[model samples]
Target: MDRPGLADFLRRRRELLRPTDVGVAEGPRRRTPGLRREEVAMLAGVSTDHYTRLEQSRGSAPSESVVAALARALRCTVDERDHLFHLAGLSPPPRRAARHVSPGLLGVAGRLVDVPVAICSDISEVVWTNTLFSALMGDVGTRPGRASNITWRWFTEPGVRDRAPEEERDRLAAAHVSDLRATYSRRAGDSDVTELVDDLLQRSREFRVLWERHEVAVRRSDHKTFVHPEVGAVELRCEVLLTPEADIKLLAYFPLEGTDAARKLDVLRVIGTQTFATA
Candidate 1:
């Protein structure tokens, strides 16, 4: 690994970004040229000391997860992200269809403060989520391994389906199954997709029935009702923004204007973040 080069690249990238670019406040006193080390560490999901050591060229090689997080935090382009991986003595992710979130998309997600936003992979795995999303969806990032996937949770975990309305549960389950089918067609031999499908077919009769239908449907704009324990029921319009590669999608939830859902969302924002059981 080129330690000095990596340190230089990281420092330069950090200096290029401003507070406003990443949805952070500038504050009153203006001394620093760009975002602070702590701010980047927070955005990248790493310890401040670790990031500092990397900048100082005194840290060990970062893992793929940390490199990906740093790429997102630095808002690096595809080429820059690849360069970061190479500098850390790791192979860059394949250029073909894969499940990875883009740095630009991550930057966009960070800018959305009022709404609950999450980035999901092609197979419906929750790659990243903002704070509001954690409050609404029970901290999906904390789920174990494949459980972080929506389809996996919907089939294997009973509590996950409990959040949706009873009347709509069947339809939601069908939709999730159909979406997984679409992904399975694109990523036929992928281990994650294959294992998830096999596990679901073994564990869930409902999923097995839906999978047999061979339904293929992409997600679109729709209204979803979620039952939050603290805020009760909230109905929000779900919108999806696909990245250029089409492997990652940004899912944002917005409450209708002048509605009780909007008020409930406000209550959630005021409540801040809280821990909830993960499936």
Candidate 2:
């Protein structure tokens, strides 16, 4: 995966970035030229040994913050930061990538039920989720093919109507895809990413066509509505949170203020629990 080359490249890149470029003064007798290992390490707030290990590709993975510090030390651009992360097997910080899910993260998703909560990692893989989220979408998790992914399901599956009737479905689907696209742009070469695109192209003409437009979107604010067969219509506000370390997105769905969506959600929770117990 170019780990060694990437590490070497990063190290050389850092060394090549002179103090002048980073707005630091060039000290006397720079024998090797470029910033000293000590200088780069100091700026990155890491031990010289650690930085050396990273350059040699002989170290454990670095934290996102540490990587960010290193990126700054090397004067990496945004694309470079993301590329560095990809080489290191990390998602870019909560801003541009999807992250793996942990128990604590699942707990947060479970607790925040007034909204649908799902966690996706880089390349739009659905790693973990809460019950209310699955229930609202009407067996989305059980659907064939890419239906397991919100973006995939929305764009590539024919099951949207079962989850939400016409008008509401399109809005939610569009917003979700837009958010997914924003994340995808930073790491376009991930294999799963290519698979998703291929599947969509082959399975859904709409996604195939939209894929051509190359419209990118970030997970900004959006309004979503779902017409649940059991709960009638529900309107929600969407918020996306990027997790530290892994660029995972925590997407939450909140009901519109003072809406009956709250009670509907309660019912969904009960239903979800029952379903889980049975399965």
Candidate 3:
């Protein structure tokens, strides 16, 4: 690993960001021009000491996961992220495997405090969720492994459908299967996609039935009714916004017109687990 170059890059990137840029409030006047090292470490889900070592050109090369996390934490662009990988003596992740929430995009989503925003991989892995989204759909992060994967959870766990209206369940299931089928075709022999499909075929008879139908389409827009126990039935217009590389999608749930959905969301924002409601 080009430790010196990686250290320099990390330092430069970290110094370019301010707390507000990443949804942090400006508290207790800071002497530094940008974010503190601890702040970057916290945002990247790493220990402050580890990040400090990297900046000091100490410690071993970061793993791929750590590299990706650093990219997001620093809000690195595609080009910058690749340079980081190169400096670390590692290849940049393939688009699908690196389907992380762009820190820039996450910052943007963070500003939509009242909206339910989530980032999902092309393969339907729930990568990240805004707090409102967690309150609305339940927390994806808390679920373990494939348990947090939207498609896997849908096909394997009936309880995952508790929020969706019973009538809409079948349609949602089919859409998920068909979308995954498209990924399976595009990625043909890629082990990740292949493994998911093969396991699903074995796990769910319904999945096997849907696969047999041979439908192919990417689900872009859909209307969903989330039957939240507290808010009654809340209707939302789900819109998908793709990243520049098209490997990750930003999902924003807007309250439907002419319903009490807007008010319900406002309520959720306030009662946000410990705060308030926007669910």
Model 2 spans with C-alpha error above 4 angstroms: 1-99, 113-115, 139-145, 273-279
Runs in model 1 with CA error above 4 Å? 96-100, 142-144, 190-192, 256-258, 275-279
TM-score, each model? Answer: 0.88, 0.55, 0.81
Kindly list the per-residue Cα lDDT of model 2 for residues 1-279, writing each as its tens digit: 456966787777876777765445677777766787877887566789888888787877777656765775676666777787887778776444342244345456646645677666655555445557778864443333355576776665565556565766656656565655765676577666667767767887777666677677776456777777666788788777776644676778888887887888878877763433223
Scored against the true structure, residue 72 in model 1 reaches a CA lDDT of 76
Per-residue lDDT tens digits for candidate 1, residues 1-279, read: 889999999999999999988878899996877889999998887889999999999977787878877887888877888899999999998763233566567778888888999888878888788888888887786454687788888888898877899998989998898878887897789787898899889999999899999999878666789998877889999999876666778899999665699888888888867645657
Local distance difference test values of all predictions, in order: 0.83, 0.66, 0.83
Q: Give the per-residue lDDT digits (tens) of candidate 3, residues 1-279.
A: 999999999999988999888877779968877888998887666789999999999987788767877888788887788899999899987655335566667877878778898888778887667778988888784454697689999999899899999999999999999989888887789887899999999999999999999999877888999987677789999999877655678889999998989999887777775533466
Question: Model 2, residue 213: what's the lDDT?
Answer: 70
> What TM-score number comes out for model 2?
0.55
Could you tell me the TM-score of candidate 1?
0.88
- Candidate 3: stretches off by over 4 Å: 1-8, 46-62, 86-89, 95-108, 141-145, 229-232, 243-245, 274-279
